[model samples]
Target: MALTTGQHSWWRPLAGTALVLMATAVMTVMLASGTEIAGELANRPLDSEGTATWGDIGDTALALLSIAFAIPAVLLAAHCVQHRPMGTVSSVESRLRWRWLAICLALALPLVLFTVAVQALMPAPAGKSGDLAWAGTPAFLTGLATVWLLVPFQAAAEEYAFRGWLLQAVGAWCRSPWMAITPQALLFATAHGWGTVWGFTDLVVFGVVTGWLTIRTGGLEAAIALHILNNLVSMSIATAFAGAFASDDTAADMDWAAVAIDVPMVLLYATAVLWVTRRRERANGTDVPGGPNTSPPPPTPQTAAASRPTGYMDPAAEA
Candidate 1:
């Protein structure tokens, strides 16, 4: 939101958005091409997919890294066009709040695990094989290793682009938070590519929820945590189930049943995170922005005092 608060011409955000798109495209292509060249030289043949899939370590890593290019692209656009610190795209605090991010990650793990359990208990879609086999130990280990290493950055790149960059870009022109939030949510859903109507709606809901959480928390940490965990779990499951990744199914392909489960899981996470943030603010005696659920905890008293101008005296102390 601070990106929107600065004094600049109206065209700045528009220009920044344009730069982001161009930069993302160029960077992704170059990165993907580089990966392919490296793969060829290594005799591995890494072909980047149009969409992210879990077929193999090479393909999976390519998909993630291709998308991950958005981070530097967005950051560059923010700095060059908006004249703001790259970190401001991360949070109103101008940098990642590691403690808050960790808290959200902790809150997300159980809920995601519970969702996976529920999915496991549910019947498989009709006509789709319910049977699953172990991907051989070596392949499985390699897949898992790739996921753990790249999925977090891949997921964070998305949050940085959507909830972080796009949201703030829109915010720069629009005074209303929803005005900023809605466009990015819709765009996020669209980026996943359309499948079933239910799945599309579900993706939209995910965007909206995560976008709102980004605003509520005054940072992308909440959204990023949820996304990273969701991708990690989903990809891990696919890796565990032999041949599952060969199929082209994505979140966009989810049926109503999947949507029903996913929608509520994200909502629950958002609610619980909000509660935790509120509790943190209260415990720290920090000013809560917006309302009870708002974020980027205000400076502590000692921090506040230390930040005051030289020789400045506190009126309360003088009294």
Candidate 2:
């Protein structure tokens, strides 16, 4: 089906969501079946010294499947690109001033460092060392590369589907900024149900910040860039710690106390982002939709006529 323009109706968003869910289901089945096949194949003898691990094969299959899951989102983004650019996309380079980027990174750095420090303070679990010795192995490295590529694609797809397209679509319908952001944030959080409960909570909070960024900036690129950077940093830190602290029997235990410190740091970073962006908008005289600067212009004569019908024929009949 052809994609719709703007938020004229609910059908487009519903259709897009249906497409995403169907694609997800198809990818899930493919991965499950491929995993079973890989498991059977792994049992066979090989000429090489080491046999393939089912875990490695499964990871590879899942990575490939993730790309498949992103197909619908990619199509939807293409559709948006063709129809009209979201105001946010147009403002990317201008709004994402170097100063703001630096502030965001600076803010994020302290939170991440504090998180790591708190983990250090926590008592080490018996047999738990967060090390990635396995990562150095040839097989594992190959699998890791595959996962790295696919994981970002998955994250991008989800953000595009929800934050990018859905936000625009809903805003068009409700004609209110809050209506657009609220449900999308809820949906974004709900989508993370498979993650740890705390992880889901973190995503919801992150979603709010990211959604606001999209709204404030008038484009998805800023939010997308930030989201990607955040994930890349998070994964890198986690992997490094996991490799360094790997134990014979257990994974490294997370320091929850550090998380307590990190949360406030993220809020501070978000505040900085808002300040930088709002300043830019004001300087440029750009109309920030739904913001305080937004005011209805005086009605033109044509607008007044359009509202009121003439005696001879209905305005609708004239059209």
Candidate 3:
């Protein structure tokens, strides 16, 4: 949902953003920087970018956990700034619709499978095998558990930050959806660091699609669903084919023609998710996307008692 009037104050968003950045920075560095590699790891020079080791997996999980706190930051920010419920920055319903999130996740399954299948078809160079047998090992299972549990929180935290907090704040300031999506998407891509042209393009494409999905779905459900499943698929494939403990960077040049095909596929995937979202809304008789039902629903007693805002009204407005 849109940020309400007076959300443009610049105080809340700025404060929340500062706190999130500082906290995530300090925590992630502490989590990732200190772990000593054991004899079980495939030792490499400290500077070489290669497959992951046991220590790498631990660092990655911890880093993802660091990013996951944005969800709490958002709620606290909303309350402290506007004294409004979370719905003020969420969808028209004024809160996260758990049913919609579940349905979107179901819709995302095929997309995730397709992505993994495509990556599988891409050729992997020699000397890059990540002990495919490790998939059956206890160590791999432990990594799998960590990824399955923490990765979703990592993805959700990003969506809530870019698509939830920053998106609505920008929307409220500029009073236009374009402003909301463009800068936030740019920030998202930039945060991931530089890569090859195709790789950078891929992030941009993903950023735009998820931004548009946030606008279309009026909540983080569709966006979060897409993010969570995509990361899960990426992690699983890396574990199965490449080393699960690999570094996040690449050094040598590789052909990206296969990745090029995925750009259009991302747009198609986003469209499919949105189509499902609108379809669900239509079945419920809302059809808000194409119609003028953008007006938020009236807040009920449940919402009032819930200590979260579900509508685009400032708590002070009601006061």
Best by lDDT: 1
Off by over 4 Å in 1: 1-7, 39-55, 288-319
Q: lDDT tens string, model 2, 1-319?
A: 0112223344655665566566667777776677556756767343243533344334444644564475454354324432332322223221223444455555456555665566567665455453434455554455445556665565566666666656655654553456667787778877555434555556666677777676665445445555545544544443433232222211112234434554565576677667766676576554332234544465576553332111111112212
List RMSD in Å for every model shown. 7.3, 9.9, 6.8
Model 3: per-residue Cα lDDT at residue 97:
75
TM values, all candidates: 0.84, 0.61, 0.75
Alpha carbon deviation, residue 207, candidate 2 (Å): 1.4
The ten-residue window of minimal lDDT in model 3 covers 310-319
Report the C-alpha lDDT of model 1 over 81-141, residue by residue, as the tens digit. Answer: 8776677777666677787889899999999999888888899988788888988888888
| Candidate 3 lDDT score at position 151 | 85
**What are the per-residue Cα lDDT tens digits for candidate 3 across 54-146?**
455666775678788777776666666655665656665667778778877887888678866876676664545533544446656777788
Q: Model 3: residues >4 Å from true position, as ranges?
A: 1-10, 26-54, 125-136, 250-255, 287-319
